[model samples]
Target: MVFRIRPIIGDSFKRKERIGNRRARFSSLLALSKFDFEEEHEMNKQLDVHTDTESGLSGELNAAISRRRLLAAIGMSGAGMAAGALMSGGIGLAAPRGSVTEMVYGLSADCGSCVVPATIAELRVMTGTVTGTAFYVTDSGQEGHFYYDPGDTSSPDDTGLVLVSTAGYRFKRIYEGPVHVKWFGAKGDGSSDDTAAIQAAINGLAGGGVAFLPSSTYIVSSTVSIPYPNVKIMGSGSSTVIKAAAASNYETMISASGLSGIEIADLVVDANKANRTGLTVRTVAILLASCTDSSVDNCIVQNTIGGGGIPGVGIALGGVSVRCKVTGCILKDCGVAGKAADGVYTSGTQNLIMNCIALNCTDTGFVIEKSSLSGIIGCTAKQCGAGAAITNASAADVTGNFIDGLTIYDWSASNTGGIQIGTPNASLGALLNTRVSNVTMERVAGSGPSVYARQQGGKIIGLTLENIRINGAGTQGILFNATDILIANCHIYNTTNAGIQSQGACERVVIEGCYIYGGSFGIALTTGCTGCHIVGNVMIGITGQTNYGVYCFGTGTNINCIMNTIENVTVRKIGYDAGTLPNVFSSVNAGISTNATATATALGTLSRKFQIFDKDGGSIGFIPVYSTIT
Candidate 1:
């Protein structure tokens, strides 16, 4: 629905004139004409009533009235149309057909061709299409890849090809026609110079194709770098090996900077020699920084230099930007005593660590820090010193990882947790929202508790545990202290203290549908914490000191506890304060509500509980603080 009005100029209508408020006038005239009739009837028939007062004769008055009526009707219908013959000097208006909509105007110029007004010009529109390449390396080396040297042009290898061009320059692939390359090193075998060939191959190729390395051992001395956009270094399965010699000058085997769309896969990397100068020159394996859309997959990286007082990493990335993935790889014997860090350390954005293995690391098996929107899935870690995993200063999606023989070093250090989250000294903002926001540990094997996360600076929010199985442990099965945690459908037994512990000022904690046995405290909630709800938890064993089927502390009038039972509840000498109930409950076995008062038949079913006098609660518009155990 559009509205339009135009001005007419010259002798026929005289000076051009158009009312700025034509729409309002048109609406007013229309309402006046259809005061007692339905809107549909006005469209089907004419009113046949005179609207002009100046005309004397009946015919003139009728024509003027009919013209005004027609103008009003056209203004309502042709709301957004362009001016036609009405824009010319003559007021020659076109009569409308029953249902036709298009309007055309033809005007003549004196001693010249007919000219169409700018307001009456026809509109035309056009759309363009864009072309692109579907697949890379298409049609052999003729169309997709090329190599040319202007300095040594025996004749342009004019193969009638559309060689991949960038800024009007040609590029070449390494394996197309390789003549000679130096030999450097290989893995397992004491001597093989396949390292030099690998480096040359990587350096020679255009930054967009794949370099294939057949099964062989290569001894490497110098570091090799693969840089920029869509490059891949591949090997013939895991049989390909690259060994690094012991020397101070030896640094990173494969490193990158400011790159994108790269992949390195299927190989073994070893640094076990005694003279191992060590990765001191950046001291990292497979380093990537400020890069995106890159990956390392199906490979083995191991560092064997022990007691160098330096930290070595199997696969480490730092401060990268986006989309870096590490999958289906192995990191073993990576961290030596006094000389190693984490087996795999990822600190970046949108990174993924999936289906990998870590073994015999002196430090942490896998550590993720300061990352965003990342995930770790279906990995396994064994015989690690600290633990299988540690996450801080980031938020990650972690699931389906097997952890065993954790906390192997210093059995007395209670700080070792299988899947530890949050730490004491970590920055509050750094550990802002970490702790694997949503996780499930299904059918995982280990000798320790499934998960343990404690926060000191900031609390972990929105932590969920589902279908977690714990076989053996010395401490609590799943100890979590943060804000808003949920543990459901968990079966915990064997050696332990508390199956699930929430001891802090944490708020909104829920433990439902859990089967717990053989723990000192089935579920412990203490400290100055408030707003806790524990319901539908099943505890099997009924013997222990200070045992509680469902316990809460540091709560006042606003806390709730309902629908929890113990098959065998131990009664200790220490008396517990089961304070006044603030929630509405039907009976002992029925459900309850968070909005209830003590000694009431039903909440909010009676008169006011209390009245406000001279003192207004606290400062202003306030309520008194609730007790911790209510």
Candidate 2:
């Protein structure tokens, strides 16, 4: 039982309101004053209140009050409505039945005088049967797509309902989706120039609407920008391809600027990098400039150039974007050398870059710099000049990041970078509390290490590297210069110098449960290092030039070595030379002694035990650091 406040009269009620040039008569309002209480009571008595059909609202309405009382109350309410309408301008027009109508086929060009004569692809405009006063275009896709002359200044109540002066206007399915490009006369064939049609389809949508592309190849010569917020452009997986036309000089295929909730996904973008030119111009397949809460997912963007904004990116969330993502995309052959190009570049806060593959990029494969609380997960960068590069470029120190599940391979021999966090001479803020785990970096023909964390100005505090595998490097397998670091459960091999090396001053370094092999030095700490705990690590099989297994040059104090295994080294296992050494030193593993002649092994403060202080805070014996007796 659909409950509606309709007058109980044989003649329907009507209510009329002027909508721009057209009008709507609600019909039910005009019959309100003619409703009779006795007539309504008679009609309600025959409703069969005991027979519960669907809603069972009859039982509720019938039992709540007597039919005579209910009908009398409705009659009084109807009289009040009539009095109110008379007070407000008065209902003067003759109520026509229904001014709205739907039609299957389109209308002819000369159907009405004031209706637009343009061709109607689907729904046709109809002339008003009653003296050409009312106008309506019924059929449209997505329930609310509209067509109007751009010169019409007055805004209508509904976007779909634009009633002009007459009813002869032809209906055009302006692009709106769930807005499909096909509805806006975009021929997705390879030869056609679908730039204007696709652009109009995007512009037709209101905010927070989606524009969909079916499985077809759409060729375009210019850029298509999404200027509205909360708009999405989607495609039918890989079969929906957007390819650049021959000699297309557009800087970008698709772009959006400072819009939120914007997404570009499920499409194949072929930038035609071979035919594309302009070495000085930056090129991209999809660029989301300074847009927040956006993403580009499940896309294949290839043959793109980088030269536009320092580092050309296949899909970029540029200029301090926040909470954006680029996932499941394959970016290849982007950026020429010295142009600062990259795949999936984002300079934002709290963004996510995951499961993307960047191959053969001329510069960095993936770069997420100047970001806070952002991460790159399960991404691979292969055969690029640089791979998986990131740094904190801001002045204020920030923290909380995870670089996990990243695999980088075959960094260029000329470039000294692979999975790098911070440069040695960078004038930036500290990247603190960062974790790099489950990562694999390999360089078969290169001079640089697999992983490098070198910060010059601001310190990298509280860094953790675990479950990592680094193979074949030039100097060290991992160049670690961060403070308060932990390198645990890692396998590093085949380096010219040490497996894990720290050049400059570092503090509180811990190397735990790691396998270090085929390098000259297993763990090398040089100059101004302090508070190192080398524990439970297996260092064996020194390759190339035979050197000490674990070397420490100038550890100021407190360098503890416990349960560390070393073998196959002619030099001393644990070597510490030079620097100040006046405190208690302990016997370490078998390696090179301090210097050539091996005087007393001096390890500034190799305190294997802790001191137990008395309650009086004086004269307490030390609690031995290492529990080897057990």
Candidate 3:
């Protein structure tokens, strides 16, 4: 049954073919030389056909048939109405190999006196532009895709929504899915302003969809905002980046403002601060403002403009934002020089910043201020002004904020050091229950990263600083001005000042189960401090300092020092200021204690109250309650 394939509609369009075990293969006909290959092949194959539709062309066609004659007659004479019906619009054209196929791009060849592709934006779509609808049009007279939002008030040129010189097509009435930013003309060349082109893709998402950023570098001059809810824009990891333009004052590179369910992931944002000379206003790399239940994950953000604080501080949840998430991000070199800016800052309630790292920031590495019930966990900060800060000024008490598994190291003496919980305004009400635990600090400087809690202008109702370890070189140690506080299981070593100091008006503060080493005074009770109990501690003092194990100064009282071991201390184990009140002590011992006016044998000259015994069941000596001279 030798079947004949009627001569291909035209002859000039070369159609290459190979025949094997009942299979007909045709080479791409440069797109325009289109054909219904499946139907034509099936029909021909059913009849045991061979490659006989070979011909040569010399004449031209018209827009009446896709101009270049892509609409050339698919002559299937008697091949059945199925083939005929397919040739008409009843059957859709098969999609090509690639989603995007560029053809006859720039150079203009004439089609009968009219410059080919005088304007692609003005090309009449097979289906004219309609509201909130997607239509297929010719890509500069080839093939193209575009959707219309007649209500979109943004400038069309900026959006690239109405494209100019390009070529591609889409299957008519196909299911709409995530659109690529490049489809809207994003060059991603790392230089061209592709912000509008990319934003156009996001805006034209029909109704709440995703915009994919391919593995390319897109330069944005301003923030790419997600104004509506449930909009997601993602990229191909580090290979895909959105960079800030030179000298452009961008509040945020990518922003989700007043919208929820937005996701920003797997991308890099370069703020380009080296060239941002005129950037006066604050800068943020990415910000979710007043947005809830959104997320920013696995993003690498470098050189974020702090705008002195968060509008980003790299990535931020600002503007009453709540229940959002920022996780697995690396922030580097954020904040402005000679000014304060944080790596990650949030004043939003119930948000989370987890497993994130901040490096070389000018201010706090991560800040939770005036926000309630938020948490920062498993984070690290290096070379920052401070590791983390939790403060409340006036905007609602900073209550129930928690920081766990934080590591801060490598700070300078000139910087404000360590983790701080303070009230900057000093007038706010009780900042209730802020806890910092499982913290490790190494090579700390600038007041020695002591987990300082300076409760001023108001009161810290409940502060818990536990399971802290600070070591290897610092200027000072932990300072507390908080009330109803618990400082337990802390190991602090090698500070220039006292290991632990209580200042301001502190009450019911318990410092126990701690190892304090290498400081002038192991514990100092200072002005407005009272009701402090220091128990079960090992305090060691370095050489060349007064080295009192416990020293009270200024105005404080009701201090209890019990079950403590002091070693290598020069001054008395428990001493007080010349005019301060006497402190109570019990079961306290010292390895090497030097009292200014007393010695151990002085007990022989004073009245004896008790006796000490050796391990061999022998009476060692008589002990006295008061022995002053040594």
For residue 229, model 3's alpha carbon misses the true position, in angstroms, by 0.9
Ranking by TM-score: 3, 2, 1
- If both were scored by TM-score, which would come out higher, candidate 1 or candidate 3? 3
Best by TM-score: 3
lDDT of prediction 2: 0.65
Q: How do all models score by TM-score?
A: 0.58, 0.68, 0.71
Tens-place lDDT per residue, model 2, 1-630, is: 112333353433222432222111112222333334333311123233322322211211112223233223223223112121211233331222321132122222211112221223333333423222212232232222223333444533222323332344422222212456765557788889878777876886654566677778998888998989988888878888898887777678999988899988888887776676644467778888888999999998877775655656677777778899999999888866655457887777898889999998877788777777888899998988767766776787767777888888888734446777764355668888888899888886667777788787678999898999988887777887888999999999877778988868889999899999878889888787788888888888654468776787764566766667877876877777766341223334433223223334443444487666556888578654432221
- Total clashes for model 2: 27
Steric clashes per prediction = 26, 27, 14
lDDT of each: 0.50, 0.65, 0.65
Scanning candidate 2 in windows of ten residues, the lowest lDDT window is 54-63
